[model samples]
Target: MYELSLIALIMPLIVGLLAGFIGSKINKSFTHWITTLGIFISFAISCWILIEVFLNPFLSFNQNIYEWMSIAGFKFLKRVF
Candidate 1:
């Protein structure tokens, strides 16, 4: 379970890196199409993930990515939580 969650977290970064690398080698028109298609696919997957979370909240986990300390006396934690 832990491993699966870790994989889920890392998969997007890996995919994005690969896509960006490939996109850089392609023509502008082709790169635009590829990027658009990738974004659409990502959006679809995100919707599915949201629906799954709604249907089964217990299956999801919160991941905190970072924290920010503001000089305006505001402390914020950047998170997937």
Candidate 2:
């Protein structure tokens, strides 16, 4: 269970990197398509994650990847209790 959750967390990152690498190697016309495909794939993964979380409400996703706390000394840690 833990391992599956971990994979869920990491899959989008791996896909993004793989798609970016491929896009960089391709021509300009295909680059847009490749990057768009990557974005679409990531969006699909997010939708799947949302559905999975809804189905299994006990599993918690505690990842906080945004760094918006340092803007004008705004503290996020205190606000998210």
Candidate 3:
């Protein structure tokens, strides 16, 4: 599930990068299709995760990637969940 969540999170970034590079060297329509496909894939994964959460209400997904700063005992956490 976390893997799927990662894919859903990263798909658009990867797609946008590839589309930018490919579009600059090729046809615009091809780039459009590539981005659309990426979006669909991400959306599908998100929907699946949503369904899973609905079915199993006890499931939890939380990731603390970094603690960027601690200022005067206040912590800034970067989380992905």
Candidate 4:
């Protein structure tokens, strides 16, 4: 679930960065195709995740990707759900 969530979130960023970096060197059509494909895949993954969550309401998706800070017995974590 976390993997799917992260992929759905990061796929666009990765694809955009890649497309932008190679946009000038590659054919415009190729870049456009890749960007569109990336967006579609990300959207599909997101829809799947939503369906899974809806089907399993008791499923816990609390995942901590990073711990930002810890002070005075308090922890600040970056969570993805």
Candidate 5:
């Protein structure tokens, strides 16, 4: 379970690094498109993960990435489930 979480975290970092590296080597116009596409892919994967978790709660996992300072005594946090 821990390993799976680690992999889930690392996967995005790896994709970002690879996209940046490849984008740097390409033309500026094309680089923007590549980056946009990467974001779309990530968003699609997130939606899919959400659907899977909704369909089968027992197999789902959640992670809290970070928190923001409280606003009006209300804390803000980012999480994945």
Candidate 6:
């Protein structure tokens, strides 16, 4: 089981952000298409994750992408489970 923690999760967010940035700079005609494409990709990834979970009975795979919060010596991982 492979967990999509680091690169996988951030890609869609980046795409959406890029779309918004470009949308504001350009005309309104292409804005909807770019936003729609980003949403579609995000939906597709979610579907794939659901499919992987459904196929595997013992799904305990997790990947720690980053340390989201740190207080003193404690480290919190942003994990995909």
- Candidate that scores best on TM-score: 4
- Model 1 stretches astray by more than 4 angstroms: 1-25, 64-80
Number of clashes in every candidate structure? 0, 0, 0, 0, 0, 0
- Per-residue lDDT of candidate 4, residues 1-81 (tens digit): 878888999999999999989999999999999999999999999999989989999998677889999999899999966
Write one digit per residue (lDDT tens) for candidate 1, span 1-81: 344445555655656676688866768677666656656666666666767778996885666677666667776877675
What TM-score, to 2 decimals, does candidate 1 have?
0.47
Prediction 2 TM-score vs. true: 0.46
Using lDDT as the measure, what is the rank order of every candidate, best first? Answer: 3, 4, 6, 5, 1, 2
As for TM-score, the candidate ahead, 3 or 6, is 3
- lDDT per residue as tens, model 2, 1-81: 445545656656776676678756768677666656656766676677778888998877565645656758875643211
For model 3, the local distance difference test gives 0.94
Q: What is the lDDT of residue 44 in candidate 4?
A: 100
Question: What is each predicted model's overall lDDT from 0 to 1?
Answer: 0.65, 0.64, 0.94, 0.93, 0.68, 0.72
- After TM-score superposition, what is the CA distance of residue 31 in candidate 1 from its true location, in Å? 0.8
Q: Global CA lDDT of candidate 4, please? A: 0.93
What TM-score would every model get versus the actual structure? 0.47, 0.46, 0.76, 0.79, 0.49, 0.58
Q: What is the lDDT of residue 15 in candidate 4?
A: 92
Better of 1 and 2 by lDDT: 1
Model 3 reaches what TM-score against the true structure? 0.76
**Candidate 5 lDDT by residue in tens digits, 1-81:** 545445555556766777778867779787666656666666666666667767887885667779866799887888876
Model 5: per-residue Cα lDDT at residue 59? 89
Model 5, global lDDT: 0.68
